[model samples]
Target: MVAIHLTSSFLLIRHFIPFMKKKGWGRIVNISSINGLIAMPGKAPYCFMKHALIGLTKAVALETAENGITCNAVCPAYVETELVMKQIRDRANQNNISYEEMRVAALVGFLCSDEAGSVTGCAIPVDAGYTAR
Candidate 1:
């Protein structure tokens, strides 16, 4: 549980933050999930990690913002990736929504760009309106 979700982000930030600090331009995009903001039934571990990831992103954002670094998170719901289709095709189909894969990349790309210089600690959703409810 800790290794894949929690520890990995922590370690990556710890390892590379200094380099970014040295360069004076850094962007951190943590890929959270809709479950992080809204819980999903029977997906306790996944939800927990994503929720934790949100906290991590927020803290990291505050810690590094003044250093010309920005940390934001992309929260996508049921993106049409191979892993999602393979694992949750039945449930996703039950939701009656078509695939929305590009949204995730689009949000991440915006967060990484210079235009979003002041946008940090945000859990931007790319969920095809799933979280709108």
Candidate 2:
């Protein structure tokens, strides 16, 4: 989980940030989870990695902001992906609620665009208000 959520980002940033620095523009968007902002019962390891990912996003944002680069995270809710479905099945008895399918691609797209140049180091939630509770 650490490798998947943290190390991969670190490697990608280390690899590509040099080019971004040369070009003087870049955007790094990390797909975090709503769990990064909140907590789920019995998901300590997963939650820890997600939270660390947000921390990484912030640190990278600060490190590269002076070079016209922006780094942010989009924290979406359960999206019915195969991996999530497996977890859902394992916790079926615990959660009986349904989730509206909220799209995150648009938010990611915006974060990658010029309009969001000043929006670095944010963990914007696309969780259909789940974190509001």
Candidate 3:
């Protein structure tokens, strides 16, 4: 997960940086997971990948900020998207909770806004305070 996701994002950004630099304004949001913020049992690969993504976001943001570019990561513990519904559902079942309770979508929305123009190099969590523990 770390190698694939990390390398792919780097490659994609490498190909696009020139264009965004030319425009003097850009925003790059990497959709990372709360695993990036903390650890859990039997989730080493995921945690490693997400942690790398946060590092990448910060590193890239620093390198690009001078050109009006902002790079950040949004760390979500669970969301009701089809992409990971099964995983969230399984977790919810194990925890004796409802999957519906995990459908969060905030950090992404915030980081994508014009008001977040100066909020670069951050891995803001959208995990319903999960990482606060």
lDDT of 1: 0.84
- Give per-model TM-scores: 0.84, 0.85, 0.80
TM-score of 2: 0.85
Compared with the true structure, the alpha-carbon lDDT of candidate 3 equals: 0.82
Best by lDDT: 2
Pairs with steric clashes in candidate 2 = none
Model 3 pairs whose backbones collide: none
Q: Which ten residues in a row have the lowest lDDT in candidate 1?
A: 94-103
Reference-based lDDT, residue 75, model 2: 94
Task: State residue 37's C-alpha deviation in candidate 1, in Å.
Answer: 0.5
Write model 2 residue lDDT over 1-133, tens digit each, in one string.
Answer: 8889889988998999999999999999998898889989999998999999999999999999999999999998755687787654444434443333355777889999999999999999876566897
Which is better, 2 or 3, measured by lDDT? Answer: 2
Q: Each candidate's lDDT (Cα)? A: 0.84, 0.86, 0.82
